[model samples]
Target: MQFGDFYYPLPANEPVLQYAPGSKEKAALKAALKQLKSEKIEVPMYIGADEVHTANKSTMHPPHQHKHVLGTYSEGDAGHVKKAINAALKAKDKWANLSWENRANIFLKAADLLATKYRFQMVAATMHGQSKNAYQAEIDSACELIDFLRFNVHFLSEIYRQQPISVAGIQNRVEYRPLEGFVLAVSPFNFTAIGGNLPTSAAMCGNVVVWKPAHTQVYSAQLFMRILKEAGLPNGVINLIYVDGPVLGEECFNHPDFAGVHFTGSTGVFNHMWKTIGENMSKYKSYPRIVGETGGKDFVLIHKSANPDVVVAALLRGAFEYQGQKCSAASRAYLPSNIATEIKKKMVAELKEMKMGSVEDFTNFVNAVIDEKSFDKIERYIKNARKRDSGAKVIAGGKCDKTEGYFIEPTVIETTDPYYVTMCEEIFGPVLTIYVYDENKFDDILKIVDNTSPYALTGAIIAQDRYAVELATNKLRNSAGNFYINDKPTGAVVGQQPFGGARASGTNDKAGSILNLYRWLSARTVKEVLTPVTDYRYPFLQEK
Candidate 1:
């Protein structure tokens, strides 16, 4: 079986298509969107070799156009969760024992199919189902997902090659064994790439997975599931389910075969899962690995010496791209007083030019939030800021309208109080809260930035002053896991900047890197004596 050395060399990140006007991708994407919209799809839960459907079903619609139905997926109870777990466990031995090269090639082939054949269809699904604009859809569903599939293969290969050194007349190697049981992949609605990565990352390591996507993201999630099947993924290797969170958790957490969880969502949920696992530690076959990336109150700190124009662009894109739904989105800001006025003026002017509407239109920069619940939560934040006694003033785009879709204008709030609720909380929307600091008190403001939020996820500092950048980087080292200099705080590419954070932002396992892959693996040190043992006693026992 170990006849030859097989290698999966590091792969380049997939190129993001621009989808320019009149381009082939644009045309293909438009067609895909039209075709998808014209038809209604019935999505079934994939459990083992069965497509399980139930009388209880949930319909999906585009977040930007709630009136139009996209599809309906089967909703299951606790029973389905048990079925999924059982299916995963049933498939575990064969999947885990399969040759590593064959396992790697299956995902590699999926990446190619996504990059070429299913590219437009995948992008269109994200655009319609998640309300992401064309560019965002292309980047997330098409490009990033492809990169995750490809890059993870290379990352895992690197892990496999790391064998321990052996001494004379002895051979030693480390076997990266998959966890003893099944993994649970709970993914959020924000990023399609995250949805794909969560399940496949565990499965790529020869572990079977029970994947549960956010109800709102199942449209694209199901499509990716089908693609995986077409790419030769066997049934029960990754069981896709749609079930309520509590029902799923009660079953999986209580199951003895629970091996680990690959999660991306809120800090509250991650903490609860960790607590539940701790409470049920004795019931599990092995200690369950928990890897999660959670919430953030990501920030942008500007210096007086920074260019106002650069700050305006960074603030606009960082705070509003994908409607500020990213965990790494710039939600709070500390601006120097010297440039605040000019920056605010330019930011408002730019916000005015931005088009807010459905994702079907190629020109719209801001789209709707996820759903009605998210829309209301965001509206409350804006309304709270507008209160006369709140010490925060809406500087630009505070309008909220859900007449057509869950639309909230790209809003900017300037607060006199540094401790304003809007400045401290994780409002995952397009409402950015800014606090102006005196130019002379840059060092003091850095301290405030560090102490303001419980999250240490992502933050940016834009300044021409090198010393200012260095000072902020050093002083606010623990404030953010991903720090940007002279740039915005969002847009982390796979394999380049490994993403995740500490301190209330989950485990900081750094997805998109080998660090995350290690979570699903249990290493076994294999040692073989080349020289035959002639005696029962060792040299030390015989001599001394």
Candidate 2:
């Protein structure tokens, strides 16, 4: 097949459907949900082309409705992880040697399938499994995953086209090869798109992957794998396994064929994995490429000149969308006292109208946390804030209930101290903390925000004044990887935003762009001389 001469069309970000009242998408989503609710799926571990089952199994339940069992997934042990790694190694040679255009076509087909025939099903799986509302599920599982597939293909082409400059007598070129061995993709539970992207990004670039998705997200992950298989992805190119994290880590990190890791999850887990990989560095064939996107203490800083309505809206959407499960969700806010009162009043009013419950109900704006553990942790934080007399006070919605499901009401805490525990820590739920700063202390507050947390994932500056916006933008340059002006600090689009952060957040690989694709590549330079110097360079001595 022809390679370099072929040009695939560049891809734009997929448009998100609203799924509003009486919409066709809404009707389709409800049907898919009903169909899923009627059956209990049996998910298996995919090793090479084989679907492997184990005696050990784990039940899958929706966070918004924990009593309902959606399915049961086979849980693999350390042996299964090793088998997955072996399968990837076995398939690596042929898969990597295949033409890039053909590999790209497979993923492109997957994207098309996701957009058309499987759109409602994918969204429904996300909703039932992850407890995301219809709109959130559509944007994440359907649009975002499609965006990753299409955009990464375009990015791979761009990388291949990048060649070194040739001198007059020498021809030079650079080849972007996939990593020498298999990649271990560890995905998070929050976004189905992330679960899909982490593995497929490496696989699309010709690297075989041993993927272990978050245990809670396995149901949707299964659907993602099915889509890839249907789109003609070769067997063993990407192996999916459901295994305990520590068990998988021990086997994969110590393996000789472990070439890289593509991860998205907690900071603590990422750091521990990094240390483990370092300790086992000598066992690997080469230094493994480590790429991860971890936790965030994202913020929104509002200025005195900001519009109250805008500030309220940004906080409402940024802090509580998807029940604040997004890695880029705004967990803290710094507001100028001059406009804080009005903003608070408007925010409280708006939040009171928000419905909270199951994803099955389209009217509910907020859903339950991922599980009981998440609900308990967030409840503790809110409880502590409510009990505190000195530094913090509950401004709105500080109640929680776990009877039917792990539900935590969307809460807002106003703190006297800027360094309040809720402000610095990442609760990973629908809890937002506000620190109203003096209007004159904008610069000082900026410093406080920058130094408050170990994370720098995402943040926003809401200001109508151009000077304030520019000042905050420059001052908080290192504070957030994705910065916004007059906007919320969430909802990072694939191509447009290119999301990631530094410091404790992650390696700042900038997923959804060429930068992330570069992480999976190993470059080799080639130079060929037109004229052979068989006489061994006597010209220099003669000239002297």
For this target, which candidate reaches the highest lDDT against the unseen true structure?
Answer: 1
Mind giving the per-residue lDDT tens digits that candidate 1 earns over 271-307? Answer: 9999999999999999999999999999999999999
lDDT by residue (423-448, candidate 2, tens digit) is 99999999999998999988899899
- Residue 524, model 2: Cα distance from true site in angstroms: 1.1
Instruction: Count residue pairs with overlapping backbones in model 2.
Output: 0
Q: Looking at model 2, report the run of 10 residues with the lowest lDDT sum.
A: 1-10
Clashing pairs in 1: none
TM-score, candidate number 1: 0.98
